[model samples]
Target: MFSGAQISLYPMTDDFVGVILGALGALDPYRDKLRIETDDISTLLVGPPEVLFPAMRDLFVAAAASGKHCVLSAAISRGCPGEPDDPICRSDAVGGPVGPLSLRKDAAIAAVREADVTGQPVAVQFSLYVMGTGDHMDEIYGCIDFLKQSGVFDRSKHFCSRLRGDAGAVFSTLNEAFCRFGPGAGHVTLDVTVSANSPTAI
Candidate 1:
């Protein structure tokens, strides 16, 4: 059995591609499977677990160098085709004025309001599907609760199971949330998507 991970990063603008792709090139040596594709501002990648995580770390650092924000996702597999999975987390939740610590429910809602052209009572919806040995529901909630305290959201617009806020805050928050559910250095695979419309699932 083997498990791998994938990363799809949405740049703030199209011009950021050069920086993202360049980072991936520098990070390729860390993974056996590495590929980069773009659609508008999104960058996609697929590779083994070990290489994937480190590569993502590098990509995050690369992204931080030029952009104001970034979102990342990781997964692990117990069976299938890949390496072992690791559930241990080492990323900081709150690092700066905009990091995890800075993310609050009210602040989250405000960011959406600022970004939305409609400016109508804005709301964001999403569903999380996770697979692993232990039940990570509590850990998931922990992330959401943390978001609420950060003053970045307005109490989760629709469903408040996971988290709700600006697209960027939600994505980055989810990136940290999902990391909690990864397998313990085993083999795992993860996919996270963010869109204007979403189904109600938790």
Candidate 2:
């Protein structure tokens, strides 16, 4: 059972390099808890959901705080059979007995409600993929139901859903979607893009 995200940040400014470099400092608190590696394309963060979402939120907030439009794109995944299981990725959020879908949705909503509030506001669009399952659509539909009531949900779009709200709630909702919809130990992935301070937003 492994979990992680490959994330890239793009700041819309002449000083993109400065914004990106300064924003990375936000991950300092999570350094010990996650295995982080940055390359030209993106940064990989391998860790539990508890630490993962917050670390991302902080980093995004830091970049957005620069008053520059910013976008964060991420490919988040868990229980990937191809990847070697790392102890650092261990978390209660994965590999557990999955109960009723109704119950899981309830629990996920509760978790999102309790997320720490960040002042930054963001909009995200994402699609969840529950791989290697015959009843994957059932899981995806269930996740959709959860999102409609997630408070952060903005609307549905082609091939994905849109969410808008405080960074805390938006990220928490994403975390829940990743953890609760699929088989606890099965391969699941999320294609996500988040934006803040976008000049073209309307």
Strongest candidate by TM-score: 2
Q: Which stretches of candidate 2 lie over 4 Å from their true place?
A: none
Q: Candidate 2's residue-wise lDDT over 1-202, tens digit each?
A: 8899999999989999999999999999999999999899999999987788889899999999999999999999998889999999889887998789999999989998998899999999999999998999999999999999899999999999999999999999999999999999999999999999987886
Per-prediction CA RMSD (Å): 11.0, 0.7
Off by over 4 Å in 1: 33-48, 68-128, 131-202
- Model 2 Cα shift for residue 110 (angstroms): 1.1
- Residue pairs clashing in model 2 are none
- Model 1: lDDT to the true structure: 0.41
What is candidate 2's TM-score against the reference?
A: 0.98
Who wins the lDDT comparison? 2
Q: Considering summed lDDT, which 10 consecutive residues are worst modelled in model 2? A: 90-99
TM-score of every model versus the real structure: 0.38, 0.98
